[model samples]
Target: MHELIAAPFLEDFLLLRPGHASGVKIRGHHYLELRSLAAEEGPLPGWLCRAAHRRWGLDLDAHGSTREVVLVREPSPYGHGRASYEVNNGCNWACPHCVYGDKRHEGLPWPQRAKLLHTLRDAGVVWLELGGGECTIDPHFADTYAYAHDLGMMVEILTNGSTLDRPQLLGLFTGRRPYRITLSVYGATETTFDGFTQRRGAYRKFRRGLAAAREAGLPLSLSVVVTEANAHEAPAMRALAERYADRVREYTHMSPTFTGGSDPLAQQAPDYLHHRTPFTGCDAGHTSLNVNPFGLATVCKISRDHPIPLLREGVAGLTRLGGIADQALRRHSGCTDCALQQSCTTCMPLVTLYRKAGAPLDRYCQHA
Candidate 1:
């Protein structure tokens, strides 16, 4: 893995560390504007060296010059700088609140997966999030992650933290390091957690994984997921997460599945179902997208109506994405004439799911 990445981020250029979130935004031409700098083999430009030292306290000069630096020469044609990919739909735990109704342990083979990564890089994606039913358990997890990091994309992982404590995984993460590893906290106690996940010994594994990650000093974030099954232990869950992670987020709302299945909605805690803020607009298809394991690209995770077969057309398939996003974000037929349209907080794709599930109006609409 390259120690430093100098890549084009949208309209601006950035100097970023492999595992770190913060970066130095490159302004003015300096070394980056010079096309020859990318091809030349020598010490890194003095300006870049200085920027790295000032920003990350990195000694690029001592690191044996430009060969260690990964320089991106061209800008992205898709105009997208970030994306989230589901490496597989498989999970070790069967959580009731999972938005993906069906969990399948399947993904593209390594060869096709490599092609997808290159396509994402060529499309100018810098921040890539790898998720799944549990990405850590995927067969190609290690290779996919290392390849993405080598391709100059800062990788973030969303996982259940089950297999994180394994020696191989720990070694892999310790070596390459991810920009962030977000673990989903189901419950505080073994009974509550294992019961919630429908997997015995889940809580024990989670605790072990948490300890391993903290010991390794990996960048850690926690999502304290709140559902009816584990709502009673919410406080404990938050406390446990805070003990291990510096960054903790709470997820209270449970949405229907990506396929518009409402099975997961039954797990939503009534008290936690707060009103959503009005939907303004998003840059989902325009500036960001979501991809499934099969290389099907959609506007976002929820709006899966029009999926562009990325493997067939490659990045060119993304041309239809912006238009698809525009259509998917519009108000559904039921919501189109509603008087609360202005203050409605739920996006159209979500609203469509609620409508499909026959969800109570109060759950998503203002009038209810």
Candidate 2:
């Protein structure tokens, strides 16, 4: 049965209309090699894989699509780890759709931030995401970049690109791709940008900032958060993406599981959740640690309750959280039925967005 199910799925994926971009077997398994598939394509492969597994218990996509490079470190005690630090959680643009919104703006003082990086470096963190509402808003953005560089950690910043126009931003990546600057382009027009962020005339600043970052010879990754308002504008956005090939990553809105209120926080049913393509086993609880300025730690960024304190501790301590590393959070449910599940980032934070307690593998992930 396994062989029969897998054979057809492979054939179907291979026969996908535009044919395939690249195909080369690394070892024993076969992968339908391709460059990139949109969110719609994510679930198809995973759902078919699960059906094959259920019929005969075979995992077809054991070998994921090959990437241009590898970012994770080996010999990691926890089996996986994602590195990050709190540079500052304030932003220049006020995108109403932001999950963190004003909450992230309230951050730790300069002294605490100074110690935070040293602690992360001591733990052997390689890639540190300088995430926030926006890291570029800090007056010491360049210094922060230098600090991360000095610690021998590759830095990545999540920003709206309003400040990248500053010449100093280039110095960080002059000779090499020192850092990754992700510019979130909510809308191509000033009206849309201003409307979403509640700030007028933001499009101009973002465009200039992106040009500055590109001019600086820095690596740029565009993160587009698609919502109801901008769904129709996808084609234009895609054309915009074509301007910057292989550097853009668009994330469709994963049902609003957090308190990020756009315009007004209309009371929605807690059970009213939305599903995308594949169900991913988000090991953030096991793979990464997200700490706010207050020192409260949770598995993912949307956590609002049952928080663990990791201000003084490190990534290794995330496993020792009160409710983490439990059987409930060991896995999630419904993912096995997903077709694009293989490409999904199926983290619990992505699924359990309504604010739940304990990290049990059974809560959101349950393998069929």
Candidate 3:
């Protein structure tokens, strides 16, 4: 007998791909890809049949006697709940442990970036973070922020606060301002700050920028990153950070270089360098994604070397990227019975490092 096929019944929201992967949520229950849903043979659920008929005019009726699967690809609303885009890859300060490392400065043009932002907003991306070598340093920073703001998206900017005091840059936030500005505080003192950044008088510039942000009435927070060089001063730094903003965040762990292993200039700290609780797995590509200056989306900033161009493939591409990230999360055989499993930063990327270079797991582990 000939096979009977019924159109796929996708939920009202977008489905990135099979496996019920990440996508936007509109109303009601979550959406599932037809191909994946059909993989399981059984009586069709009433909800799936109803949604197929009502939303997409798809009648998911397999011949009364036999069942056949159906698939559909039509223009659908995408759900980009949250996203972070690196506006440019040109940092003013070169921190020794910086992983960004020599990435080309091929930022998307202003016009193209504006379109990308609009597309994201249209696709239901609610929370957007604009960051970069330094987002404010980008020539089109204001234009991009204004466009994102006008689209009804909550926008946030991450910067080192080097140019926050610039009159021209300050003007952009004078009117509506972003949801918040996250300033990375390198050190509590000028000498340490300048030493870490390798920029003469950067500390002074950062202070001026902080004052400017306050003057503009922008909501602000401080991010104090812990490194071996600055670990001793974290307590003092946290105290200073609180004075600047009520909300302060501290990062105690540094991952391997994107190229893998230690960077000559941006050296990776010892495995037991600064103290941090062990991480079981990474949520990159699943809960969040990082978009580089060139619009390549990847697992996270640390995993930028492996990236997928998000604009070209949309949510479907995200599905593939998520799978790659998930594979990276699979536990190594050695980790199954290890005593330090909970204390190791033993995620997929780290496992790739261990397998590729044969580096001691403890070398990349956050805990001793």
Candidate 4:
């Protein structure tokens, strides 16, 4: 119920509002000002009251006291400040393009999930993304989401939009307000969408959810996934998404499953397979990391080689993550001898998956 959250974000400090994307970054005297104000027992200073109103459309004075503001004075010892957590690898629809091959409906119960969220907060994660085979379908979706929001982390959800229409879910989101909810659009029409998902009435459900989300005025983003099944409707999908969301993105390339299975690659639309830009570098483990449902931490979602056991080792386990990221990004066996290494756009982990799957060279390699 705190209106304003003051916390350390890496080297900087942030004054964030729950359910809102816009925030005020403060340091030096400004940070000191808010810190002092948060410690006071009276009504908030007029400047802060006015600033909150002007910035986030929040009227701090209406709250009547400084108790509405929460400040985290302790700086996190961990370097990473962002993470993507898979709430569960479970989904309602069975899309062939899903990167997670097996849709197992399993995740930590509320108690364990609460501990993991606390760990993430203590580990300096300010921006948290909750995703999965379909995170909204997770039994603990509402609980996990509300807890993360209360922890003062800006939360983003990656969902398939099937469950968004539920009255309970709409009420939850309306109350807490996610930073953003990104939904994937498989197709524009019911036949293509349901066929692509291999589930009957999927498109109808998706539209219902989309309408509910829109009506709620919750922040929305859309991902138009172009696959062999839906490529013909790509333009329509984009147009439909644009109408519903403020931000719309189109994704054509399909990657292998996290377990190095190429099952998803079969859904790739050939005409949409454009060459990627040259591989430069990434800051996965250094700045961000990925965590599975069971609390296994990896450098990133793509490089899930040797996962660090977060539950066992705690935050200390993340110390070895940067090294793992370095190793995973390095040029591996196939790319080591390639003459076009500099021009090769695919990263090493992806190249490894491509090789493992016996996929067409043209899909990832310059040699083709």
When summed lDDT is taken over every stretch of 10 residues in candidate 3, the lowest stretch is: 1-10
Q: Mind sharing the TM-score for model 4?
A: 0.95
Residue 192 lDDT (model 2): 64
Model 3 RMSD vs true structure? 12.6
Between candidates 1 and 2, which one is better according to lDDT? 1
lDDT at residue 202 of model 3 (Cα atoms): 95
Per-residue lDDT over 1-368 for candidate 4, one digit per residue giving the tens place of the 0 to 100 score: 77777777777888777778888876656666666766775566676677678888876665666656754445678867899999999889999988898999998988878988888888889889999889988888899999998887888999889989999999998888888999999999999999999999999999999999999999999999999989889999999999998899889998888777889999898999776789888889987999999999998998898899888788888889999999999896767787898888988988888788778888888888
Residue runs of model 2 more than 4 Å from their true location after superposition: 1-80, 257-277, 303-306, 313-316, 319-351, 355-368
Better of 3 and 4 by TM-score: 4
Q: Number of the top candidate by TM-score?
A: 1
Error of 4 at 6 (Å): 2.2
- Give RMSD to native, each candidate: 1.4, 14.6, 12.6, 1.8
- Cα lDDT tens digits for candidate 1, 168-247: 99898889989999999999999999999999999999999889988999999999999999999999999999998889
TM-score of each: 0.96, 0.63, 0.70, 0.95
What 10-residue stretch in candidate 4 is worst by lDDT? 65-74
- Taken over the whole model, the C-alpha lDDT of each candidate is 0.86, 0.51, 0.64, 0.86
Instruction: Candidate 4: count the clashes.
Output: 0
RMSD of 4: 1.8
